[model samples]
Target: MLNLNGQTHRRLAEAMQQAMLIPEGDELVFVIGRGNESSNLEALETWVKESLDVLEDDLALAVLPLLLNRLGQTINHWSPV
Candidate 1:
């Protein structure tokens, strides 16, 4: 399983919401394959790469960070702190 911080979750939620605003109404689906750790992570990476493959230059701005740990290790690069 994977874990994500509240802020990271919110940011992804917001990004998805905004992405939905695209004029053509193109829907985005996140496919995460369930399996062993490496297998799942690999699938996720592939999905991300595929999703990014279609993003327009200007629209392909930020790829939010994943919070795999709950300790202080997880840092949001955009945060002032």
Candidate 2:
């Protein structure tokens, strides 16, 4: 399981956001991330490439808790009983 705490998730997701703001075929040459946020993003990207399926919407997860909440709502609608 990807066990990221709320704060870490938000921070890393912000890193993901900043990276997204860069143009395609270009690299993120500058980033204003805390040390742990930088490390977390590096690790998360590596893990995603190595192990998981990363979606485009995952790049927009500035608030992971909200994503979780939305996912819960989705699940509640989809699951039967």
Tell me each candidate's TM-score. Answer: 0.26, 0.26
Predicted candidate 1 versus true structure: per-residue lDDT over 1-81, tens digit per residue: 134444554455446545655222222222342333243334444444444445534343332323244233645554577
The sequence of per-residue lDDT tens digits that candidate 2 reaches over residues 1-81 is: 445455665565457657766333213222333223235445444444334234534545656888899999999999998
Cα lDDT of all candidates, in order?
0.41, 0.50
> Model 1 reaches what TM-score against the true structure?
0.26
Per-prediction backbone clash count: 0, 0
What range of 10 consecutive residues in model 2 has the weakest lDDT sum? 25-34
Superposed Cα deviation of residue 61, candidate 2 (Å): 24
